[model samples]
Target chain A: MYKLYEFFASGNCYKLRLLLTQLNIPFQRIEVNILKGESRTPEFLLKNPNGRTPVLEIETGKFLAESNAILFYLSEGTDFLPTDSFEKAQVLQWLFFEQYSHEPYIATSRFWITTGKAEENREALNQKRAGGVAALKVMEQHLTEHQFFVGDRYTIADIALFAYTHVADEGGFDLSKFPAIQAWIKRVQAQPKHISITQQV
Target chain B: MYKLYEFFASGNCYKLRLLLTQLNIPFQRIEVNILKGESRTPEFLLKNPNGRTPVLEIETGKFLAESNAILFYLSEGTDFLPTDSFEKAQVLQWLFFEQYSHEPYIATSRFWITTGKAEENREALNQKRAGGVAALKVMEQHLTEHQFFVGDRYTIADIALFAYTHVADEGGFDLSKFPAIQAWIKRVQAQPKHISITQQV
Candidate 1:
């Protein structure tokens, strides 16, 4: 069986779990408390030099890191990842956008705020607030015209973006302004195998 | 015919040009001077709402954005992209690494320094310096053991990384310590149809 080294609360980890559960693929979930520095331990480092959680251990020794990369790998040969060339690129476009543009601002703010670390770094939080809002604006604009992020289908791109976006309010981002995104969240949640962010494996 | 909306000096844009040249794929280059806010204009926003350059006009009225995503799209079915599932994910892992870990530090530093803006943000440069060093160290450690990033063969993973890495010195990063990366740079250049970063389409 595949093993997932993950922290339950992390959206990055959740993206993989959500996809696996949707596909009904079986995998073991090993909790790694990042807040406790468990991921930085030497043995974990041996598993992933990057020292990150949500690592997919293909077997005893083989492993894969990076949440989006894992999503791409697991979604292969499935309808989750679009096969059309332009659609594939667009899926990847959103994946990169999620990492570079969206997650950095939205997820970072959520981590800092929800963990009660927001008090110490008001300046940093303020800085991230604008960027997080900007990312949402981009999504809001796109979600308005299209139900999903790519190919008008429920795809990995939606899963990748949804991981952080649905819980964006936890990061202190108000979702009230984005009606399209609000509806998209419900649409995703209404899927046949939809799972909550807090759901355990 | 394909058209690339790009800024000549951007390493992100350079990655696509480099690959197209190596693949011998013909494309028209339409330079968008980002420094002048060209990318942010309404016209460009229609092409890519993200308002970033290196937008690939796959056909009239159809476009794709994000540099790494474009590379993946153009490289499909070519030897540049790995065919195996695990290997493709490995390539993506590195691509994500290049964007999140490597580019933000190394590429941003280069932009700030070379554009005569480094003086205003010495603290930011100093902040990036450590992260940039950390990224390079990771590359050095990996390259020391393996000849290429994902598999032994050259792939778009190398091209994505090479875009910024080859000119990391412009960012005030010292590559002298990374003997393995230095050697890999020479190896990439030694490949057939290799083009310089400044080479026009």
Candidate 2:
């Protein structure tokens, strides 16, 4: 059996949990409350010196952190990772997009809004919210014709982006503005073995 | 032929250049000067919407961004990526470590210190420098025993970590404190096809 150390609300963690369910892989879930600073404790830091969440622990007790990286780890040699060279690179491209362009804006806005800290830095939060919308719009434009993120199939790329994008509403970004993204989300949820983010493995 | 779009001084770009040399993979280097804001132009953004480097343009003209992602792409189905399941995960583990823990601290501190922006944020820069050194110390501990980042072999894990760890001194973290890392650097450099970051493709 494997173990997943995660925060309930994290899209990064949720991405991995969703993959586990879709793959029918059995794993124990250990909740690390980031709001309570559980990740900073010596015990947790020993597992991942970076002090972040969504670490996957294998049966041998070795811990792997970073949600996208864990998704790669689990998806290797599977259909989730495209076998074609170009398609594979495309997967990596979108994963990188989710990190640099998308996460910085979208995740930050979600953090500020959901935690109700947006009032403290209203101007900055607003700017971030706008940027988040911009990123979502990029996805919306792409999703208009494509059923999934990279290829014509469901992949970790979709899982990676969907984790945060689906929750963009919590960050005060209006999802209704992007009908393509709305349709794409429904398409993803319609997949077999799909699991909700809050569900336990 | 493969082409790499990169900035002259970016470690992210340098990582790919380093790997290409080691693998004897011929590539044309296209320099995108970041200081002049070349990455923001519409033409560059079309290649990579995130507008960062290094973007590896395959023979098909499809571009790929994100340094770690590019590393994974080029190294796939090759010896640079580990074949074993757990070893492959370990490679990803360190790649993620480089991104989350090492890059935020080490790369940022280096940018501030080397580029002489430390005066503008001396206190904050000092705090970051300390954090960067702490990360280096963690690497020192790991390198003290392991020959490479994983499985006693030179994989992309070493390539990813070495890109920054070798030049961490530019970040204001004294490398002399970590003799094991120095030894590890020498080990990586001693490899048959290893190339210095200064030497461009």
Candidate 3:
């Protein structure tokens, strides 16, 4: 049976849980609270030296980390990942962009704010917000030209991006300025069997 | 023909060029100097709105960015990328770690230092160096146990991490402590048909 080691509030974990639900795949979710230092425990480190959550125990003793990697693993050979080579590569590009450009700014801000640590991280947040805005602008431009991130269809690319993007506002990002991204959010939400960011099952 | 728009100093660009050469995949490399703001030009923006180098034009007028994604595309069918589903996912995990954890810290420091911008960005470099060291510590821990990043085989995961890691000293990181990583670098370089990171062919 599949098992997921995750923190409920994490977008990285959410991305994996959301896809598993969308695909109607059954799995068990075990909470690994980062704030409490659960992920850094020696046992957890054995599973993932990186000490991050959303680790998928694909089978007994075999595990995978990195939410996008987990998403790709579960979605491959299914409609969620494209069969065409170029489209597949495009999906990967957006996943990398989400982690590097989008998440660092948007997700981290949300984490700091949600946990009441914003005051201590104000300067960092200000810098991150600027980056967050730039990332939103990039997404806005892309969504204006294409309905979806890759192949003009709802795939894991949209799933990977949708994780933190729909909730970027909680990170102090003003989404109203990004009309295209706003519309794309609605399109992704409209997909069949879609689950909310924090939902499980 | 495949055309790679890249900056010679960029580890991201080098990841693709290294893999293509290792796989005996013929491709054209066009240098885009980030120092002169060439990648930011209107013409280059048409290729990648993100304005980053190491964009792979897989075919005429069609492009893909994000270096790890490009590596995945070129190496999928070859031995560089594993055919097994689980092994492939493991490779993706490392690729994401390289970009998010390793590259930002290591590659950015190398850029600031190499460009003589470290003095102006002292605080940023110091912060980046700490992160770079932490990332190296993680890799050192991993390599201490496994010879390769995944399946105990040489794969694109090695190439992706090697791009920035082999030169991390340029970022003021002391690699003398990461004995395992130092050895892994030699293993990757010893691969058949392997090319130095900055080589064009």
Candidate 4:
């Protein structure tokens, strides 16, 4: 059986859960409370040296960390991964962008504001927001013209970026500013088997 | 013609360039100096809104951002990307780890020391280094038994991690601390088309 160790409200964990639901995959949910430092415990750290959440443990006891990785794993051989070589690479490209560019700005800002740490570096937070909004605008522009991030259909790229971006407002980002992103979010939500983060299977 | 817009010292660009060399793919290199903020110009941003280094311009002038994406594009349909679904996901898994777990810590620490930004946040810098070192230890433990990152083969996973890690000392990381990684670096360098950042092709 596949078991997912995750923390609710974490964009990273949410990405994994969303993909599993979209694919109709079955897995047990193991909650790790970041607030209580459950992930940092000796047992959890043994499972993941980095002590981060959203680890997928296969039946063989092998575990996979990193949300995007889990998405790729669950989405493999499915429509979520493009067959064309270049398009497949494009999927990876956006996934990397989600981590390096978008997540750093959007996810961090969300973390600070959601956890009430935004006031300490409001100026820096705003600067990151400017950068994050710029990133969202870039996505908005591409998404406005294309149905998916890489090709004509939904891929793991969309899943990876969709995690934090859908809730970017919690980080004090004004999603209403980017009409294209708003529409793109709707398109993603409209997927036949889509699931929200708060859903229990 | 396929033209690669890149900075000399960027690991992301190096990953692409190294793959191009390995594949013997013909491409022209156009320098974008990150230090001079050339990537942030209107002309460059038109190619990639992220304004980051290593934009791969395909034959149709279509620009591709992110290094791993470029690697996957250039090495498409080749032996570089595994055919098995799980194996392919494993590659993505390592690549994702390179970004979230390894890159943020190792690459950022290296950049901090290389560009003399370490003084700006010495405490935070040390934290990143500590985290980066912790990550390297994971690699060390893994490398102690395996030659490549996953499945005993040289894949883009190695390329992504090798980019910043080979020059970790530039970021004030003492390579001598991790003998396994040091040996693994040599193993990668011994590849048929291995290229160094300082080497001019």
Candidate 5:
């Protein structure tokens, strides 16, 4: 059985949980409350040196960090990952974009606002708003032409992007203007075995 | 032949250039001077909606963006990428860490300083310093245990990380303390057909 070290409300963690559930892979969920600095503990650091949530213990001693990488690992040879080389790379393209371009702004802003740090980090939040909007605009443009992020099918790419994007409103991003993204969100939710971010497996 | 749209100095662009050269694959390098906002132009935006350099034209009208994704695409069948499932995912784990945990701090600081925006972004620079140092510390700890990022061999993970880390000093990061990383830098440079960041094909 896989042991997932995660924070429940975290979109990064939710990416893994949603995928695992959809794939019908059973796993043990161990909540590491990032708000309490539990991830920074020395023992947890052994599992992941970066001290972040969503570490998947593939076995008792072996582990994998990075939400997208974990998704890639678990989805291999399954329908969630495409077999074509180009399509696989395309899936990775969006995954990287989510980590570098999308998650930092959209997810972090939501974290700050929801964790009650918005007032203290107002300037940083202001700086992040533009980036969040830009990411959404990119998604909106892509979603306008395609049904899913890759190959017109619901893949882990959709799961990866949808985790935070569905909750971007909590980050103070106005998704009302991005009708394409709004429509795509509904498409993602309609997938088989779909689960919300807050759902416990 | 692949056509790489790139800015010469960028670590992201260098990753692809280094891999293409090492793999003995011929490619056309189309310089997109991001410093002058060339990447954001209407023409370039058609190549990559993200408006970023290091977009790989795999063939006519088929483009792939994100440097690590390009590396994964090109290195797929080669020894540059491991064939084993677990090792492949480990390579991706480092790639994600590079983009998320490492690049934002290490690479962005280098960009701000090298592009003469450090003075204006001093507050931001100060903020980034801690993150850069922390990333290096993580590298130091990992490199101490492994010769390469995964499978005890050089892979795209090294290429992805080497792009920024070798020039981290330009970002005002002190590398003297990370002896393991310094040694690993030399190891990466010693790879067969290795090319410097400034070297044009």
Candidate 6:
């Protein structure tokens, strides 16, 4: 069984949990309180030198870090991932977009605001709001034309982006203007075997 | 032939250039001067709504954005990408690390400094410097134990990371302390058909 070292509140960690449950893959979830610096311990560092959560122990001692990479790994040869080379790369395009362009602003802002660091990060939060809004506009533009992030089907790309985007309101983002994204959020929730971010499996 | 819309100075764009050259794949380079807001123009926005450079035109009318995604697409089925599931995911792990942990700080700092905006963005630059250093430390840790990023062979992961890391000095990041990364950079440069960032095809 796969052992997931994760912080329960992290959207990155939730990406894996959602995928694993939808895939029917039985995995053990070991909560790592990132707020408490549990991930920075020497033992956890051995599992992931980056000291980040959502480390998937594929087997004992063998691990994979990076939630999107873990999603790619588990979804390969499955319907959640596309078989066509171009489509596969398209999936990856959005996954990278989520990590690079989307998550840092949306997820980090949510982290700061929800974790009681909002007052301390006021200037940083203002900066993040611009980036976060820009990211949402990109998604809205893409979602306006397509039903899903890749190939008009729900894939890991959707899962990756949806993880934080659905909760962007908590980050002080005004999603009311992004009707396309709001509609897509409903569509993602309508997927088979879908689970909420905070749902325990 | 692939048409790469890129800014020559961007390490993100350079990743594709290096891989295309090394793979011996003939590609047309269409320089999009991002500094002049070319990427944000309506016409270019059709190519990539994200308004980012390093958008790969796989063919006419079909564009792939995100530098690492383009690298994955171009390198697929070639020796540059691994076929094994685990190894392939490991390659992606590093690619994500590059974009999320490495590029945002190192590459962006280089952009700010090299473009002469360092003075105006002094506070932001200071924050980016810390992030860039932390990212380098992570790379140094990994390179210390392995010759290559994944499966002990040069892959697109190296290409993705090398694009920024080799030019980190321009970002005001001192590489003197990261001996492992320095040695790995040399190894990456020594690869067959390797090209410098500024070398036009």
Comparing 1 with 6 on DockQ, the higher-scoring candidate is 6
lDDT of 1 by residue, B1-49 (tens): 9999999999999999999999999999999999999999999999999
Q: Residue B72 in model 5: shift from native, Å? A: 0.4
Query: How well does candidate 4 score on lDDT at residue A8?
Result: 87
- What local lDDT score does residue B29 receive in model 1, on the 0 to 100 scale? 96
Residue A116 CA displacement from its true place in model 2, Å: 5.0
Error of 6 at B201 (Å): 1.4
Task: State the displacement of the C-alpha of residue B36, model 2, in Å, after optimal TM-score superposition.
Answer: 1.8
Q: What is the TM-score of each predicted model, taking all chains together?
A: 0.98, 0.89, 0.98, 0.92, 0.99, 0.99
Comparison by lDDT, 3 against 5, better one: 5
lDDT for A143 (candidate 1): 93
> Where is model 6 more than 4 Å wrong at Cα?
none
Q: Count the backbone clashes (under 3 Å) in each candidate.
A: 1, 0, 0, 0, 0, 0
- Deviation of model 1 at B93, angstroms: 0.7
For candidate 3, what is the TM-score? 0.98
Give the range of the ten consecutive residues with the poorest summed lDDT in model 1 chain A.
Answer: A45-54
Docking class of 3: high
The candidate with the higher lDDT, 1 or 5, is 5
| Residue B4 miss distance in model 3 (angstroms) | 0.9
Write the residue-wise lDDT of candidate 2 on A65-155 in tens digits: 7788788889988889897877877887788678756786777788887887888968767767666876886788778878898878999
- How does chain B score by TM in each prediction? 0.99, 0.95, 0.97, 0.94, 0.98, 0.98
i-RMS for every candidate (Å) is: 0.7, 2.1, 0.6, 1.7, 0.5, 0.6
Clashing pairs in 3: none
lDDT by residue for model 4 (A55-91), tens: 8897665888788877877876798888776777788
> lDDT of model 3 at residue A123?
91
lDDT of 2 at A95: 80
lDDT of 6: 0.93
Return whichever of 4 and 6 wins on lDDT: 6
lDDT per residue for candidate 5 within B127-152, as digits (tens), equals: 99888898899999999999989999
Q: Which scores better on lDDT, 1 or 6?
A: 6
Task: Encode model 3's per-residue lDDT on B12-72: one tens digit a residue.
Answer: 8888888877777788899999999999999999999988988999789999999999999
Name every residue pair that clashes in candidate 5.
none
